[model samples]
Target chain A: MTQALVNGLTLGAVYALVALGYSMVYGILGMINFAHGEIYMLGAFHGILALAFAQHYLANFSPVVCLLGALVLAMLFCGGYGFTLERIAYRPLRHAPVLSPLISAIGMSFLLQNYVMVAQGSGIRGFPMEFGRRLTETRFSAFAGAEFSLLEVFILATSLLCMAGLHLYIYRSKMGKAMRATSQDRRMASLLGVDVDRVISATFIAGSALAAVAGVMVSMYVHAVKFNDGYIMGMKAFTAAVLGGIGNIPGAMLGGVLLGVVENIGIWFLGAGYKDAYSFIVLLLVLIVLPRGILGEQVSDKV
Target chain B: MNITWRGFSGFVFVAALAFAAACGPKGGAGAIRLGVAGPMTGDQAAFGEEVLYGASLAAEEWNERGGVLGKRIKIVKRDDQAKPDQATQAAYELVSEGVAGVIGHFNSGCTIPASEVYHQNNVPMLTPSATNPDITDRKYANIFRVCGRDDDQGRTAAEYAVKTLKVKKVAVLHDRTPYGAGLTDQFKRNIEKSLGAKAIVYYDGFDDKEKFFDPYLQEIKKKDPDLLYFGGIYHQAGPLTVKARELGLRAAVMFGDGVINEQYIESAKEAAEGAYVTFGPDPEKIPAAKGFLEKYRKTYQKPAGAYSIYAYEAANILLASIARAKGTDGKAVSEEIRRSPHESSIGTIRFDGKGDIQGSYYVMWQVRNGKFAALQ
Candidate 1:
C-alpha cells in the first residue's frame, strides 16, 4: 500500500510538472497548449544527446557536471523551442477565430512529433545508464518495509523544488504579477503599460522549462523515450489541468497527484487494463460534480 | 450552364480513362509478379522489413538460378500500416496486379480479414508470422501460415511451466491485442487443465500502451506466483519484467513467440537474464539456413530477425509452387502448394487440409547472455 502511494507520487510529480505548462498556458491564453508534451519530449531528446556528447567528448569531466550540463541544455533548448512555437504558430492566429489557434496547437503537436520521429527513428531510444540504472539500483527504505528507489527520490525532490520555485516566482516576482494581470485582461494590462506579448512569451518559456525538467525526469525513470509518447502524456496532463479545474495552477498539481493515486488505486481493484481510463474518469466526475474544479472558480475569472 | 456541364462531363470521361491507365497493373510480360504485403511503414515496420528482406533474398537467389520457369520473379511490396482496412486494400491491389501469390500480412488481426480478399480473388497467401488459432480455423483453401498457432505455443509454454519449471502458482497477463489475448486465454486454459485451478492464481489483460506496470506487479507480488506468463510482444513484456524484478518479485517470466525481438533484451537488460519464451524452430540452427543467415548479416549489417527465416521458407514455397504449376493461376499454384513437399530452409513444407504446415514444431528458448539461446 505504501509502495503504491510512493509510485503514484513519483508518476504524479512528472504529470504535475507537465500539467503546470498546460495550466499556465490556458490561464493566460484561454486555450490549451497541446504541444507542451512535445516540448517535454524534445527536452528528453536534448538531455540524451547532451549526455551522449559529454560521455564521448568530455571523458575527463566529472559525472555530476556532465549531468547538470545535460539538464541545463535540455531546459534551454525546450525554452527556445517553446518561444519559437508561440511566435510562429500561436501569435499570428491570436486575433483569429478561437478554434483556429486550438487547431494550430494540435497541428504543432503533430509537427513536432513527426519531426522527432524522422530525426530520431521511431524506435525506442534509451537514456545513458550513467544515471538511470545507477539511480534505479539505489533504494531508500523509510517505512515498515516500504522501499523507494533513488530515481523516485530524485524525481520527487526535484519536482518539489521546481514546483516550489515556480510557486514563489508566480506569487512574489514582478514578472509573474504582470503575467497574472495580462491573463486577467490583456487590453487593460496593455493600457496600464504592461508588455502583454512579453508576458505571454515569458509564460511559455517558464512552462516549457518545467515541462523539459519533467521530460528528463520521466525518461530517466522509464529508462527510455519514444516519438509518439507526447500525445498520450500531453492528453493526460491536459486531463490533470481539467480535473483540477483548467487554468488553475495549484489545481493542476493537485489534480496530477490525485489522478496518479486514483489511477494506481483503481488498478489495484479493477486491474491494469483500465490504467489510462482512470484519469478521464476523474475528469468526468469533476466536470459533472465540481464544474469549476477544486480550485478553479477561485481564479477562473482572474486568470 | 448547360454548355459548361456538357464540357465538364467530357473532361470527366477523359480524366477517368487517364486515371485508370495510371492505376492499372504495371507488371511486365516477362515478370512473374509476387506481392509482399505487411506493415512496410508504421510501428510494426521492423517486423515487416524482416519479411521483405528474407523474401527479397529468396527472390534474388531464384532469379539468379534461371528465374521461376523462365520468367523473372518481381516482388511487389505494399505497406499495410498494420491496419486491417489497409491490408485488405493491399491484397486487392496485389491481386489486380496479376501477382502469383503473396507472402505476408504479418498480424493475425490483419491476416484474418485480408484473407477474405485473397480468398475472393483466388490469390494464394503464405503468412510468415500471424499465429492466431482462428486464422487456420477459417479453412481458407488459399491461406497458409509458416508459423505455429497461439494454441500450439500456449500449450507448449504451459506444459513447460507446469512440468519443467515446477511452478505451483501461475499468473497470466496479456496486452489485449488479438495475439496477446488469444495466447493468454490458451495459456490460462492449459494451465487450469494441466495443473488444476489452484495453479492459476491470477489472469488478466492490459492495454498495449500502458507504460507503468507497478500496480499489476504489486498485485502479482501479493499473489506470490512462482511463474508469470506474459502473452504480449516484446515492448510491454520487456518493461513489465524489468519492473517486476525491480519490485523484488522473484517469479520467473515466461512468454510466447512475440518476445523474440532484440528490443526485448534492450528494454529489460539484466532483468531479462532468465526469461523463457516459446517459438517456432530457431532459424540459425536449421542446417539449410546457414548460407542465408551469413549472407543476411553481410547484406543488412545486422543479425537475421526472428521471422526472417520463416519468411524465406514462405517465399520459397510460393516461388516453387508457381514453378511447378507453370502458371500464375492462383488455384493451380495453391493446388501445387498442397500436393508436393518443397525442400526449404525450415525443412520439407507441405500444407494440410486447413492450409497449415504439416510438420511444424515449437521449441523453447531462454535469454542467455543477453540473447536467446535454444533450450533443450
Candidate 2:
C-alpha cells in the first residue's frame, strides 16, 4: 500500500506539473489549449535530441552536465514552440467566437502530433538510459521493501518547485496580475493598459515550459520515447486539472496528486487493467458532486 | 428551368460514368502491391511498426531474388490506429491502391471489420497476430493467419500452468475485449479439463482503463489461488503484476502474448521479475532469425520484436505463393499459399485447411532482471 502511494505520488507530481500548465492557461484564457500535450511531446523529443548532441560533442562532460543541458534545451525548445503555437494558431482566432479558437487548438494539436510522427517515424525510440543514471542512485525505503529511486525524487521536487513558482507568479508578480485581470475580463484589462495578447502568449509559454520539464522527467523515468506519449499523459493531466478545479492553480496540484494516488490504489485493489477507468470515474464523481472542484470558487455567468 | 435540370442530369450521368471508369481494372506491366495495415500510431504502434519492418524486409528480399513471378513485389503500408473503423477505411484505401493481397490488420477487432472489406474486394489478407477464433470461423476465403489462434496459445499456456508449474488453484482475469475474453475462455476450459476442479477461481471481464482494483483484489486474495492468469496487453498486465506483488500475493502470474513487451517490465518494475508469458519464440533466440536480425539492425538500427520474424515469414510465404501461382490473382495466390511448403525464419511454414499454422510452437518466457528469458 505504501509503495503504491509513493509510486502514485511520483506519477502524480509529473501529472501535476503538466496539469498546472493546463490550469494556468485555462485560468487566464478560458480555453483548453489542446496543443498543450504536443508541447510536452516536443519537450521529450528535444531532450532526446539534446542528449544525442551531448553524446556526440560533449562526450568528455560529466553525465550531470549533459542531463542538465538536455533538460534546459528541452524547456527552451518546447517553450518557444508553445509561443509559436499561440502566435500562429490562437492569436488570429482570439477575437473570433470561442468555438472557432477551440477547434483551431484541436487542429494544431493534430498537426503537431503528425509533424512529430512523420519526423520521428512511427516507432518507439529508446533513449539512452544512462542519461540520468547518477541521479537515480539514491534509494529510500517507501513501503514493504520498496525503494524510491532518485529520479522519482527529482520529479517530485521539480514539480513542487514549478508549482511554487506558478503560485508566486499568479499572486505576487505584475504580469501575473495582468493575466488574472485579463482572464477575469479581457476588455477591461485592455482598457486598463494591459497587453492581453502578450499575457496570453506568456501564459502559453510558461505552461509549455512546465509541460516540457514534465516530459523530460517522464522520458528519463520511462526510458522510451514516442510521439503519442502526449495523448495519454495530456488526458491524464487534463483530468488532474479538472479534478483539482479546471482553473484553480493549487487545485490542479492537489488534483494531480490525488488522481495519481487514486489510480495507484485502484490498480492495487482492482488489478491494473482498470487504472484509466478509475481515474476517469473519480473525475466524473468529483465533477458531479463538486462541479467547481475541491478548491475552485464557483462562478456564475453574468447574463 | 428545364435547361438547368437537363444540364444537371447530364452532369450527374457523366460523373457516374467517370466513377465506373475509375473503378474498372487498369491492368498494366507493373509490380504487384501487397498492403500491410496495422496501428502505426497510438499505444500499439510498436507492434505495427515492427510488423511493417518485417513485411518491408521480406518484400525487399523477394524483389532481390529475381522478383516474384517475373515482377517486383511492392508492399503498401497503412496506419489503422488500432481502431476498427479506421481499419476498414485503410483496407478500402489499400484495395483502391490496387494491392493484390494484404498482410494484416493486427488487432482482431480491427481485422474483423477490415476483413469484410478485403472479402468484398476479393483481396487475400493474412493476419500476423490477430488471434480471435471468429476471424477465421467466418470462413472468409481471403482471410488467413500466420500466427496460432487464441485457442492454441490459451490451451498451451494452461497446459504449462497445470502440468509444468503444478499449479493447484488458479484465478483468471481478462481485459473484457474480444481477444482477451476469448483467450481467457479457452485457457479456463483447458485448465479445467487438465486439472479437473483444480481450476477453481475465474474472474473475467475487467475494464482496461480503471485504476483501482482493491475490491476485486481483496475478493481474489480470499480465494488464495496458487496461480493467476491475465488475458490482456502489457499496459494492464505490467501494473497487475506490480499490484499483485504489493498485495502480498506470491502466486505465479502468467499471461498470453499480449503482455509481451519491454514496456511491461518498466510498468510492472520488480513485480514482473517472475511473471511468465507465452508467445511466439523471440526472434533473437532463433538461429534462423539471426541473419534477419543483423540485416534489420543494420537497416533500422534496432533489434526486432518477438513477432517480427513471424511477420517476415508470413510475407515470405505470401511472395512465394505469388511466385508459385505465376500471377498476382487473389485466388491463385491463396491456392499457392495453401499448397506450398515454404521455409523461413520460423522454420517450415505451412498453413492448414482453416488457414492456421500447422505446428504448435509456442515458447514460454519469464521476466528476469527487466528482460524476458526463455524458460528451460
- Least accurate 10 contiguous residues by lDDT in model 2 chain B: B209-218
CA shift of B243, model 2, Å: 11
**All models: lDDT?**
0.85, 0.81
Candidate with the greatest DockQ versus the true structure = 1
Per-residue accuracy of model 1 over A13-44 as CA lDDT, tens digit each: 88899999999999998987889989999999
* First chain of candidate 2, TM-score: 0.96
Docking quality of model 1: it rates as acceptable
DockQ for each candidate? 0.44, 0.13
lDDT (Cα, 0-100) at A34 in candidate 1: 89
Q: Estimate, for each residue in A15-85, the C-alpha lDDT of model 2 and write its tens digit.
A: 89899889888887788988898899899989988998888888899988888888889989988999999
lDDT of 2 by residue, B1-376 (tens): 9999999999999999888777643332277887899988776777888899989999999878867777777779999988788999999999999898898988888898999998888788899889988999888777889887898888889888877899988888887877888998999989889888556575746765433343455446667889888888776676567557655577899998887777778656666888999887667767987999999889898877766777787888888787788787888888888887788776787877778878876778899888998784
- Which residue runs of candidate 2 sit more than 4 Å off their true CA positions? A1-9, A47-73, A119-121, A125-154, A220-223, A265-274, A285-303, B1-31, B42-46, B53-74, B96-98, B120-122, B157-309, B312-336, B339-348, B364-376
User: Residue B245 error for model 1, in Å?
Assistant: 2.4
Task: Tally clashing residue pairs in candidate 1.
Answer: 0
| Highest lDDT model number | 1
